[model samples]
Every structure is written in C-alpha cells, then in structure tokens.
Target: MHKSDYIVKYLANSTSDYVTSAQLGDFLSSSTRTVLRYIREIQAESNEHGFEIISNKGQGYRLIIRDKAAFQNYLSNSLAEHEKSDLNKLECQIARQLLLTDYIKLDDLAQQFNYSRSSISRITSAVASIFEGYNLELESKAHQGFSVQGSEINIRHCINNLIFNSFTMYQTARMLQVDDLDWNSFKKAATDIVKSRGLNFKQELLIQFMKYCYIAVNRIRNKRYVNFEQIKDLEFDIVSDESLTLMLELIQLICPEFEKTTESQWELYYLALAWEQSIYPVEKLHDPNPERIKFFLDIVEKAVENIKNYYGIDFTKDHQFLKDLAEHISICYWKYLLNVESENLYLDEVRSKYPTAYYYSVEIAACINESTKTKIPDDELSLITLHFAAKIERENRKQIKTIILCSTEFGITELLKSRLNKQYGDIDVIGICTCDNKVQLCHDNADFYISADQIEQSELNGKPILQLSPFLDEEDCHLLDEFIARLNTTVPLQSICEPNHFYILNKPAKKAHLLNYLCDYLLQEGRITEKEKADIFAREALVPTAIAPHVAMPHCIIQGSSFLVFAVLPKSIIWDQTRINLIILGCFHEGDNQIKNLLKQLYTVISNKQQVDKIIGCKSYDEFIKVMNDFVGEELC
Candidate 1:
C-alpha cells in the first residue's frame, strides 16, 4: 500500500471523536504537511468510492461512509498487506541498475526500465545523492551518461550499503545466484566463527561481516580486487599476517574452486583489516596497529580533556573506559579518513532513549571535529554516542557530581559545602574552585557547576551559573534549595543562531508562501536542499505546525549545519483556524540529539499565553531574541 493508505485506514476507523492532524502524524511518524497531503489524496480518491473524509476546524477528521459495502471492500483491498510501501517499479529497477553499472546512457536506462527518458532522468535524480554521504559523487556526463567518481573502496562501500539497505547480504547472494560458488559454505564459515566466539557477536556485527564478505566475494568474482599495496606502506597498521591467514583459510575453505592468486591473498588481507576494526579482544596484546591505536587514543584523550573543560566531567582516571573508547574511535575515525560512509541504525534510538550519553558523545564529537578539521557523519557520531552511553550506564554513579565556585573569604564556601553535604545525600560536593584557581575545576570531574560569589557570567564558559551571596543569608539558602530541587531537570541542547538569522515580518502571508520564503534563506545558505524543503512541507501536511494560537514550529531534516530560524509575524496570518504570529523553523541535520530538548523549551514558551503575547508584541529581531532568551533560557535561539 502507498503512504496515503495509512491516512485512509486511520480516518476510516475514527468513529467516535475528530482525529487531529497532529495525532495522525504521530501515529504515522510523519509530518503535518505529509498527513494533510495524504488526506487530500485519499479524499479525492475516496470520492469515487462510498466514503469521504470530513475535516473540521476544531474536530480533526472523521470518516462518513455513504456505502458500507463499497467502503469495506476498498478497505479489504488495501489492508491485505502491512506497511508495504507503494514504490515505483520502474524507479526501483532503474536505481538498482544505475548502482551496478559503471556508466549508462539515459536512453539506455529508459529502455531497460521500460520508461520514457524524462521519467528515468527524474528517478535517477532522486537517488543521485545516495552516495553523497559516503564522500563520493554521482556525476552525470551530458553525452557519456552517468557514472560514480571517488575512491574505489569508498565506491564499493557505498554500493554495498545501497544494496543492503533493500536486501540482506545472504538474500542478495541468493538473488545473484553466482555460478560455481559455495555461498552456503561462505555463510557457514561466518556462522561457525560466531558460534565458536560467543554471544558478543550476535548484535548485527555478524551481519556486517557477512555483508562485507559477500560484497568482497562478489566483486572479486568480477576480477575487481582491492589494491592494498600502497595501503600497507602507510604508517597505520590494521591487522597482523596471522589475521590475514585466518581470513584466507576461511576463504579457501569456502571457495576452494577459486584460484590461489596473489590478488586473492591481498583480498584476504583486506578482509582481515575489517576483522581487526570489528574489535576482537585477544588473550593478551592483540592490536597489530599500535600506532593507529595510539593516534586515536591521543585524540580521544584530547576529547576527554575538552569534555572536562566544557561539561566538567573528567574521564581521565577511567583507564579502561578510555582504552575502549579509543579503540572504537580508531575504527570510526579510520573509516572517515578512508572516505567511507556507513549507517548506525541505533543512532536515533540512542539519541532519543539515552539523552545524557548522547549529549556526552556530541561533546566528544565536537572535540574530534575541531582536532581533525573534519565533519564526521551523524551515523558515526551515533556510534560514538552508543559507546559512551553504554559506558556511562555501566559506571552507574549514584550521586550527581557538583562543584562550588565560591569566595575563599571567611571560609563561607566551606560552610556552604558542609551544609550541602549534610542536607543533600544525592548531591556530592567534590571540591571548591575560586575564579583564580578555576583551572583546577576541569580536574574535579564535576558537571554541575555552582557559584557563590557575584562573578561576571561572561568570565566563565556558558556553564549554568546559579549566583548566590557568599555570606549564606536566608534568601541565599532558599535559592540553593530551589537550585538543588531542580537539579533533575536536564540542561537542553539548543540551536545557535546569528542575530541576522532572526527576522521580524511586517506583513502577514499564507503559511505556504511564508514557509517557502523563510526556508529559501536556508536553501541559499546551503543549510537545506529543495528535496529537504519538500520533506518539510510533507511533514506539515501530516501534522499542523502551529503548536498554539499565533505560534507554529515547522522543522525538517537538513544537510550540513543545523540551525533554527525565528520569525515574528506581527500581522498574524490564519493557520489551522488560528492566527499564527510566531514561526520557529528548526532545520536540523538528521540524528541531532537536541531535538527533544529544543521542542520541550519551545513548547514551554508556546503553551504560555502571556509569553506568546509578549513575543507578538516584539517589533524587531533584537526584541524577539530578548523575549526568547527570557522564556526559553539564554542558551536557546
């Protein structure tokens, strides 16, 4: 069934109350725009049938069936399959062919797919950027047809990803049905190794190995072997000759029919490198590439130091965690340097479910990016976050590590620390750091920072500053109590924006026109693309963006830099039966860990009638920024 089938079935079953677009979008995991568009399409098609979707202002949508038999028949026909996407057969065939062939003429693609040249061209454009995240380009030559351009290893990685995204490694092997190859033995070799190993290999890593082996086997059959002569000459060592021999043994056991050529031996070494990167711990010292491990470990140490400086969490003493994290980064960072792109399927779930660890990972990623001058994919970022999340959960500290930045005068800081120690068992006061000795703070392993003296907020980093009198007055004690009470509230990750990115609109316009106009700036800035913009609108159709009266939040998954664009529409245009005066356009890169926190802060502001009114009253970007800072804290844009 098509995506629109979801809306139709949903509306058909809603008999009691009006279903809101937001409700439908949430159920479908879609945007308001997509839901609305689906509803329109479903309704237009249902008009020919016996049912029609009724859309009301306050009440969401309801199904009014004119002919029960006809509507039931229609539902039966559509609901036979579950979550079966209505993909274009022509497009699928063309996409698969394009990935396989080195180059193919547009007309040839059209003939092969049994479609017009224009139709084939359009379909190709859709999947054109499939390899872009892999640091490869799909260049379309005007006369010579389309071909991929990049490092060969990266190309293979991207191709395998594209194939495995739709089909599994074993399934693709079955479908390909290459002649005279014992595919089952190859599969058995992987299963046997995993069985001999342990349960540690159960979590999709086996499938990754299977995928890599299958791709390598298939490519080698076509006489395309990885050229690794120059790669071994490089300083970065990946695996030992023993590991390569083990891989070659497996290969020989599986495909004894193939020739024992020098090229096949090199392929064995290449495959062995994959195994080393997969991280199998040896009984003693197993890392063949100590230089690689040391390099990434140094980077990880730098990241840990930065994390301490920024978030005030010190992991330097955690030698075991440091080693594990560095080894993982060696694999992740090496893949990056090799121009390989991969998907971490666990990224979104980790970001949403494990917010704290994910943020910690983000900080580490920031340090890595700064240290190397590279933008790692969100997928890799997710992998790093996964590691940290696992480590943090394993550590499982009971108390919140906190530090006090109070005056040394009269030892009042000592008094405050004593009081905290006596009253709050959950809050651990590690030490005190004065402004002059604040350099010692990074080593304290304190994430929650508090100040007693009235120091300038600008002097310290953008750490959460709760200023109190050093004298420890009654009001000061009360403030401390309140701050301690709200310690469980998470510090939100916010979108940073320049003052110019914020706009004050003097004239009101329709939502469509306004969204386009606002997103156009992002497009020009290379923050978003036309395809991503379409996704935003589709999301809007699924769920109305307007959160409250005169306020709406429209956002989309963007490329490159993530940003939030704010607009104050003083004229107040009608949206979803209410006039919308405030628009917060959140353009985020996929797998951003901050989206949940950002929405929480934004909804807090929108739900308040007084705050909405105050924002509507603003006449300029400066005024809007001030109001936002007041409502959502100074960090939010």
Candidate 2:
C-alpha cells in the first residue's frame, strides 16, 4: 500500500484532536498539499465504506466513522478482496502458468479461469509480446498445445521470476494451477537443505527455491526436462562448496532422473550462480574469475564516466554506486547471455517521474549495447535509471553559490540577504557587494550575479546577471530566483523563453497544424528558415517527444539562433496516446549546450502534475512566467 492509504488508516483510528494537514504532513515528512491530496483520495474511498472525512475550515480535518462495526469489517476484508479480477493480474496468472508448465491449451485455461476462449486468446497475445522481450516465442503445434519456446536458462528465469514476484508458494501455486501439493513436505525439504548447507537465505528466496525444486521435479516426472546441451559451448566455474552439496542433495531428493549426467552439473553451476547473485550478498562470493569481474567493473566505471561527461553528475567517486552497478551488471551480463528479461516493477513510475535520468540511462544503455553488442531491454534500462535518479536526488540539496549586489542604504542589503537566505536555504551568499565593487571580486568563483542595479553584460566578465529591486519584493525575489535555478546548470529557462515566444491557443487543432502555426510564427519573426521548419517535422517523425503526460517538447538542432517557442493549447491536442496541451518546440543551432539544459529543465517542470496544472490555468504570458518562476523557486529552494 502507498503512504497515502496508511495516512488514511491512521486518521480513521486517531485518538487526539482534529488533525490538520500540516500536522499530518509533518508526521509523514511530506508537503501539506500532498497530504490534502491523500485526504481527498481517502474521502473518495470512503464513499463505499462506513467512514467519512469531515473538514472543519479552522479546526482541521476529522475522520468520522458512521458505523464502527462496518468500518472494521471493511478494513478486515480489504486486503483479500481488493480488485481480484484486473487485467494485469490475469496476465500475470497466464504468464505464471506458461512458465510453470511445458504446454497449456486455451480451452483448459478458459475452463479453469471461467473465461471465454476469445478472452483467453487476447490475454495470451499480450503474454506473447511480453515473452518476445526475452527472445522467447509462444508456438502452437497442429494437434498439440501452446508452449513458450526458449533456451533452458530463459525458461528458468521466467519460472523463478514468477515465484519471486508473488509472496508465497501458496499464492504462486494457485496461479500456476498447481493443486493438492504437499506443503509440509516442501517446507521441510527447503528447511533441511538450508540447514545442511548452513546458508542464510531470505524466507522469500527459501520459498522460491522450494517452488523451483517442486516445479523441476514435476516437469521431469512429466518427461519435459529442460535441455542443457544447447549451452554446452559456454564455460562456467562454480565458486561455492555450499552450491555443490546443495544441488546434489536437491537433485537426489527431487529430480533423481539426471543425477549422473552433465545436465546435473550444469544445472547446479547455474543455480549456484543465480543464488550468489540474487539471494546471497556480493561479498560472500568465493574467488570469481578476476578478468570477468574486471570486465563488468570496467563497464560500470565507463558508464559513470560517460554520465559525468555528458550530464555533469560525478558518480565516479561514489563507492556505493560502483558496488551497486558492478553487482547488478554481473547478473545483468548473465541475463543478457541467457536472454532473460527482468520484470521491473518501477518501470512506468521511473519513466514518468525521473524522465531526465531515464533519458540519460537510455543513452548509457546505448553505449553498453554498442560495447557489448547486446540488446538491453527497457525494464533493465529503467533499473539503471533508478540508480542515476537516486544519485541526482542526493546531490540536489547542495548549496548554489551566489553574490548579491545591492546599492541600497545601510542595513538594507543585510535585510535583503537575510530574507533571501530564509526564502532559499539552498543559496550560499558568499559575498554582498554594492554597485561600486571591483569587477574581479564580483566574478570570484560565484555561479551568477544578482544585482539591485541593472548591470551590463560585459560588467561581470560574461557572467549572467539577474537584475532585481533593492528591497527584493516577491517579484524581485522571483526575478533573482531565475538565476539560482540555472546557477549550477548551463541554462536559464527564462532566457530561452521570452514574453514574445509564448502563444495561447484556445482553438482545436491537430499536431501538424500546431507545428505549422508555430513554424509560420518563427518564419514571420525571422527566427528560422523554411528548411529548419521542415526539419522539425522530420525529427518528430523519428521520435514523438512527448516527455510528459500532457507536454511535448519537440526540438531540432538546425542552422538558426536558439529559440524556445511555446504553445499552450489548454483545450488539449492529441499526441500519440497522450493529450498534450503544452507544446515547446525548441529551435537551436547545431551546438547549443543550454538548449539541452533547457529541455531537461522543461522535462523536470512537466513531470510535476501541479506545475502543469498551474501552466494550463495561465491566461497570459506574465502568468506563465510566474508559474515558471514559482516552480523554480519551489524546486530549487
């Protein structure tokens, strides 16, 4: 469950005074707006329950239980009966069955799940696409059933993945159509195996291993054993004594059919490698091949180096990063060789929430793909993106160095500095100067200049100057904040987006019409040539750059001065499957570093739904600027 649901349950069981959103937010370490959103969701959920949330304007919010018995009963049955028949669950079930058994018929699935053959067929079609990611295919024979055709290792990956996903063997077995199993015997065998080897594995992996052993035994009993001869060309070295005895005992106790063949040794080696990577810690691995280990480490270090050079994030010295990536890549390389697809849970969330990092990860994945000559799946790419996102989020709290230039009377500069410090704790005001300060001192290692008096571009030796009022009111503070937003970065978004560049379109139009309209505007303004406009469409054809849900940032590096052209279509226009109301077409030259930064910043802004809401509500360019300013202030601060 999400924290929002936890907060709702807490509120429902509150014993104190009415809880304010502020108190709830503070308790949860979240924003009050987020708390209110959770409360609103809880209120919606209460529509079917016996609990209702009542908000008292001044006092705060109170959870009023209409019927205590009914509310308790609702909570009791919520977990077990919550959405039992979703398409995603059905897909998982079908995939689980395919991974467990050699062949499954549609009629058998239809009878088992109480669904029509057509419905099962549609589900199997989706499952086929998923299997295709692992380089596996669903094949149908003339008089036989359907089977997932793949290498032995890939099939094992699919089976273990299914077991790893569901919490218990009982739940997974139900999905796999395994009935009347001896649970006591399975558990005892797993316990005995772990005890004999003295291996400390997580309870989940213990259950998963038991399930794997059971499935392997059952498949062998049905004369459907996996063929290990296909991978005979590949060499492997086992590095654990525990793995040797464990595999021997498991095969002797469960699948005694192949105890004397090379298949048993291959299965033992691969299973031991899997255990060391997945269940066991990296440090526990006994003397692996040094060259193979260094190869994986080199890939990680080079990827981090490329990320630092490309996006300016120095995760090279981050030891935890090196360890995490090294360990993941070790398993990743094995999966790549075996053509096993990882089932990433946070794929969509990471893609939407941290798209900049996701994009950077794709670039990094491309480098790995070229170097290794292996196709990395999108799920694996998302996992890599998560590490980058975490590193960026960790470094986001660093101070932004600034030099404040104020020409006001005595103590006024100090007061403005204090206010600035309070408003933005992330800003480090290294020096406060008057208008008559030395030019070299103003440029002394500071990122940017914020001055009360208007400074010329040449005054600070090419440093960007943010002109602000002496008193530093809200508008002045926001104006000064634009510099802080891009202080550490190469681009200032306000510099790219001018007041003349914004256009609000209330009329309905297609993407082509909108693009042509913007291109015509640029042509009339002499911002781009006709060929550059055509190049925009050419770039769009290559990849529809809908960076967010309702935002599309389509850009091309053509022969022109950089221009950030924005079109706010509040009524919405169709782009792919998403409804885009904000279109930012960036026209830049062949080499413009700030344009990339501007695109990244725009992605950051549009990733936030609240910021998009504020942007869509804007009726004028000034309000749009304010929204941008507010977003920068909130985010940077």
Compute each candidate's TM-score over C-alphas: 0.47, 0.51
lDDT of 2 by residue, 509-621 (tens): 86678888888888898888888888677555433356566788876555666668778887986664346889888776654455435545666567667788788889898
lDDT to native, each model: 0.64, 0.64
Among the numbered candidates, top TM-score falls to: 2
Q: Residues 1-637, candidate 1, lDDT per residue (tens digit)?
A: 6657777777767666788876775565443444665675576578667888887776788888888888888878877655444343344455556656768898997787677887777777645534443445667887889886765576666656445656655567754444356767766776677567562454466566666677776667667776655454445655576777678777766556556587665677667766655535443223335687676678788877755653445678887888888787765654554443353323334554454455466556655555564345545666787877777666655477777886666387777777666655556878777766856864567656767777776335544667766555777765554454344334422335566678888875766789889878877977788999887876564334554456777766565666777788878875543457888887765555555455445555665568788977887767777876665556642
The parts of candidate 1 lying over 4 Å away from their true place are 2-86, 129-136, 149-177, 180-211, 221-237, 246-266, 273-295, 306-321, 327-346, 349-380, 386-499, 503-637
lDDT of 1: 0.64
In candidate 2, how many Å is residue 134 off?
9.5
How well does candidate 2 match the true structure in TM-score terms? 0.51
Task: Compute the lDDT of residue 288 as modeled in candidate 1.
Answer: 33
> RMSD per prediction, one decimal?
14.9, 11.1
